[model samples]
Target chain A: MENLLEVKNLCKKYIGFELKNINFSIPKGMIIGLIGENGAGKTTTIKAMLNIINKDEGEVKIFDLDLHQNEKQIKQDIAVVLDDSFLSEYLNPKSINKIMKNFYPSWDEKLYLKYLEKFNLPINKISKEFSNGMKMKLKIATALSHKPKLLILDEPTSGLDPVARNDILDIFQEFIEDGEHSILLSSHITSDLEHIADYIIFINNGEIIFKKSKDELIENFGIVRCDEKDFKSFKKNDYIKYKKNKYEYDVLVENKADFKRKYSISVIDKPTIEDIMLIYIKGEK
Target chain B: MAALKGLIIKDFQTIKSYKTTILFMIVLFTIGGFLNDDIITFIPVTMPLCFEMLAMSGFSFDNLSNSDTYIRTLPVNKKDIVKARYIYILLFTLFGSLFGLICTILVQLLKTKNIGTEILISDLSITSGAFVGIMFVQIFQIPIMYKFGAEKGRIIQLVMIIVLMLGISLATTAIMKIWGISLDNLAVMLKDYLIAVLGIMVILLYILSFVISRRIYERKEI
Candidate 1:
């Protein structure tokens, strides 16, 4: 299958923190979720892809073109919405319309107006006076109005109420419905990703811990809970990350069906993105 | 370019936000010129100086505030950002020079002086003063801004300008003493060279500032 975005051996280094060699790809028409903890290099990875921050070493290709060599052309099809609104806070939507009209070659004034009406955003209010949700909506509206083929959003759902977040996610779903559009959504909200992401890429300490299809992850990993004695009887290699308490032990197994048949312990539940992340991050340390 | 137009609009909007300050300075300078008639002589020199400070402050604000982060996230490149800043400086300098010329004409009409001679002097003074001051600020501030952001750059820029002015004064004094040339004689000798030489220097400095700013911006993480 052709990929919409491909990152190979991405590396970035700082004094104390290092984004070790990382790799991932998003297939065309798929919504890929980039999940990581607070300081797990989610923002840095997105920045590297956008060329907003320099990478010590690696290659990023979008639409099958080298990112640096064909940056302008690649960016023509790519839209980015960082955590903050990039629009001038003192300017209102009317003023922003005038400014954005001049900036994007494919900017749709009609679509922008439509979004403003749909979102019920005040046309004359300065962006600074906008609520956090309103500002995020405006940013998303501007990003989508340009007819981009690929959308790269970093924590776009952050600081948003559940209703607002769902509304935004619905827009993203609509954007990719045509099979010509793709998205790389980076967020720490694993539940949201679990609901929408076709593929999941988990990162930690600037490294890709796991990249796989959600179905495969769900099918392969199962949460096994049992008495401490039963957990002690299982081999170490069978479990990826496990926790032991006074009375019970909770463990994750790669092969749920086989493990349940062979082991006497109760393999009670499917592993979630959050459960997987918690075990992988805390258990490994 | 469309990007250039967007940047220009952004800069104009920023300036518009500071309208009250610009108006206050213009009125203050006009009054100062009238009160200190002997020293100011005309509004050409006075108005341009005041506007130069405004332009510098505008650029400083653009560099230091949250605006820098906003602008960087746009579709515009770092090189374009640097180019747009220089364009903004040119536009404001021209506006200031034109305003100064109009003020000079009004002052000449009010004084009932030699209108022809006064017009020529006022035009020359305004043009030269705006050009030199604008160039001086751009060349000095751009480097400082690139190295340190606007907040700290403003302080360093003031110190650097003061040092440069003093150095120029001492050098000119030494040249006059060695050559046995009076101030008036030196002015006469340099008058013709000022337009061509200083104009070239300003253009070169502007380009140099752009190159340096681009390099610094490209390396910046944000």
Candidate 2:
């Protein structure tokens, strides 16, 4: 697949937190979901890739152009939605339209107005007065109004109810329908990713733990529930990770069908994204 | 250029509420001018100072909203951001001086009903002096504000003003003791060249301030 963004060997260091060899790519016409716990470097990774923060070492290429040599040109096609940062609280949507008209050459004033009407956002009211969901919708509307090809968003679905999150997911899905646009969205809400993301990159402790297809994680990987005796009979190599309870064991299997064929365990449960993340973070190796 | 315009527009929108306060200040200044015509002399100093405060308020608002971080992600370079801020300051300073001059003219016309070239000349000198001094102070304050946020920058500005006061006074005393010239005599002697010297100094301060601000912002990991 043709890639929209490619980040390699990205690294950044703070007093206590660091991103170690962070790397990823967003293929054209696809959504790549970035998932991690709090302080897991998801935001840091996004910031570094966008050049909002200085990276200690790395190379970032967007639209097949070197970031340092072509930042302004590349950024023309890129849109960003930060979790806690935005234009300003004092600016109403109308004023924002005026300010943004000067930034992006492709800024569509009519489309922005349409987005406001469609979302029922007030052009006269400042963003500070908006509820959490409304604020998110405004951010999305602003982001899309520029007609950017690549959208890099951090925690776009957080602090949203199910209805709002679904609305946002629908937007993301629609954004990439042209088969040339792409989105990199970071959210801890795994279920949302399941709804739209084609790929998932899990970051843990400032490092990328794994990057897999959504179907691979959802369809192939599973959990085997069995008593302690059955767990004891299974070899250590049989399961990827196992968790022990008082009277039973839950083993994370790489392939449920193969595990079933090799062992007599008939209770292989299909794992959700959360189940996979929980096992990856808490289950024993 | 588009990026610079966008940044300026953003700052304007950030401080839009200050328009009412500015109007209030203008009214108060006008009232004070009517009560005492001598207030006309202070316009060049006070009006410019108020505009400076308003410009700094933009920085405070930017810090509050975390807009700088968001702007960095845009298509603007750090150098251009610094340049836009200095340009905004310059424009505000020029506007302030113009406003003060116009107010001084109108108020003098209303009160005395005759043109006073003598007082106008004196006020012009004071205006030039205050404008140069404001630029000097800004050259010092802006880089500090860019390095630290506007909140901490204000405290540092206070300390810097105190130090500058002490330094200027001591330097003045030493110059008087060495040259044995009265302050008024020295002023008249140097009056011809003061504006020229300060003009050059203002230009240099702008360059230095812009360079320092750009360096501070480029290295900043926002």
Candidate 3:
């Protein structure tokens, strides 16, 4: 599949934190989940890709177009939803429809109203009057109404209730069902990503820890419950990170099959995205 | 241009939401016409200054709600954002000036038997002075706001307004001394040349401010 978005050697410097040499991509017809802890440079990476924040050094290409040179054209096919609702508080959905129609050539008022109805958002109420979930829904509704080829969402589901999050995830699944649309979703909520992501890009600190297919991760990446003797039997490089508990040593390995073949152990189990993230976050490298 | 329009429309919606503040400003300036003293002189001179206050309130709302950050995510150029704000400054000043003018006319028509030519000329001068002063404030203050954001921008705005007020008076005095024009003649000169000169200056400075603001904001990390 053709890549929809690509980033290489992305670098940004702040007073206390630096986003250093980040690289990743998302293929068309795929949902790429960007998983990272707080302050892990997830939002910064997304911003750099979209040129929302200036990058010290990087090349970002969207739809095979260099981000800066073709930003407007590229943006025409792209829709973004940050955590905060960008809509002015005073504007209702109706007014927003009027305002947005002028910006996006393909803006669909019907689609917007459909999403609002689906999300149970009030059409005439000001955005500030909505609850957190409703605000997020309004942002999502706006982003989706433009018929974007790619959706770049930064922690969009953070404040949403479980039901709303599920509804949004379903919409994402439907969005990518056409095999032309793609999504780059950044979130701390791993479970949501785990449900819909085709590929997972795990970032830590300022670096990409791994970028692997979701199926590959589900089938191979795992945790092994073993004591020190059993853990020592496995080569150090076979596992990415490990933790030593009082009862047993839980080691996070890259491949369950290879470890199982080598050790012939039955304690290996599939690791959820969250489990893998926590291991990387708290475990020894 | 469409993006710029969208940004301005967003700001208009925000301005519309502040109905109470807008009403209060109208009431305050209208009440100024009731005063039978020099305070009325300051009304037209200061009414346009309130445009700065209105724009500042918009900035405050953006800052408080973090909407500026959200605006950056839109599919528009950073320069468009700056341009929209500068346009808003112009619109706000014009609207405030018009509001003040209407009030003054109402006061003149209702309270006074015959509005003398001197009073009309004085009122015209005050309004023109206010327009020029507020335009100056906007030209400098917007770029500062782009650099420092709403918090520090407020301080810079106040300081710049004071400087512009003093600068205008000083320049006027210098012109009076050098040109040997009486105060009445100076008022006529202001009435005749003020809009054309300052209007041109405002356009040039606004363009310059837009360029500077875009540079600052484009490079700024939100």
Candidate 4:
């Protein structure tokens, strides 16, 4: 399958923080979750891809074109929903609609108004008066109204309630239903991602720990719970991460089927993205 | 260009958003122009000043605080953003100049004074001066905003404006004393000089500002 977006050896540095060499890609028609901790360079990566922040080293290619060289064309096909409402808070939706109509070539006024109605947002109220969920929905509505081929969301559902979050996710699903559309969604809410993400990229402390398909990730990593003494006997390399109590231990193995045959341990469950991340991040340190 | 059109619409929307403030300023300037007995002469001077202030306010809105992030996030390039801002300022300044001219005409018509060559020259001068000031602000303020952001840039912009006004005042006094050049002569000279020199300067400053802003924005963590 062709990759919709490719980021190779992406690197950026700040005074106190640094994003080490990172590489990942999203296939066309796939919804990839960029899973990471609070400061795991998720925003940094998205910013670099959008050229909001310059990269120290590495390259980003979208639609097989170099990001910087073909930035204008690349951007035409892409939509981004940032964590915050970047729209002018003093302006109402009517004003924004007028402004956006001029900016996006494919801006659908009817569709935008439809979304405004669907989201139950008052068209006359200024954006500042919007609730957090309403603002997020607005952002999503604006981003999607342009008929963009790729959607890049950075923590778009962070502060939203479950219903609103699900509504947004449903919108995303509808967006990619065309089969040519793709999405790169960055979120800390692993459960949300678990339902929709086709592929997962796990990051921690500015480094990419793993990038794989969700099914593969689930199939490969399993939660093996056993006695404390049994956990002590297993080598660290055999399992990616593990948690221990006084008498019981829950370990995350890279290859659960192989580990299961070797050790007399009960495989408790499949690990979620959050569980995997917590274990791996702690284990790495 | 569609992109340019988009920017114009966006700027107009922004102006519309601050309708109350704009209306207040317009009425205030209009009334202030009328109340002065020397309304005809004062209109030329005060109108440009008001225009400069309005242009500055518009530029201020384009700073980091208002819509920079959202504009940047769109499928628009840094060059588009820079060009849009410069164009917005130019258009607004033109609007301001037209408004000033209309006010002058109103005052002249009211006073029953003929729209003579001297009045024409003065009006032209005021328009040119406003253009120069707007260009100067664009050239200086855009770069400062790229480096310092809106909050700190405002202070720097104020200092720069004060210095510029003082320099212009000193230059005018010196020229008048040495060359026997009055305000009308200077205005006429500016009307001629601005078209060539100011245009080139504006273009150069715009290019420079665009390059610098793009670099700074690219490097910015946000």
lDDT of 2 by residue, A182-203 (tens): 9998989899999999999999
By summed lDDT, the worst window of 10 consecutive residues in model 2 chain B runs over B94-103
Off by over 4 Å in 2: A245-247, B179-181
* Candidate that scores best on TM-score: 2
DockQ of all predictions against the true structure, Cα-based: 0.44, 0.78, 0.58, 0.47
Chain A TM-score, prediction 1: 0.95
Query: What TM-score, computed on C-alpha atoms, does each candidate reach?
Result: 0.91, 0.96, 0.92, 0.88
lDDT of each: 0.79, 0.87, 0.84, 0.79
lDDT string for model 3 (A59-125, tens) is 9999999988988888888999988648667778888888888788899989999999999999988
Which model, 1 or 2, shows the larger DockQ?
2
Off by over 4 Å in 3: B31-42, B113-122, B163-199
Candidate 1 vs candidate 4: which has greater TM-score? 1
How does candidate 2 fare on TM-score?
0.96
> Which DockQ-derived CAPRI band holds candidate 1?
acceptable
For the candidates in turn, chain A alone yields TM-scores of 0.95, 0.97, 0.96, 0.96
**TM match of model 3 to true structure:** 0.92
- Candidate 2 Cα lDDT to native: 0.87
Report the lDDT tens digits of candidate 3 across residue range B107-210.
Answer: 77667768888878877767876787677777788888879888988888789878888998899899889989989887787787767888798879878888
**Candidate 2 residue pairs that clash:** none
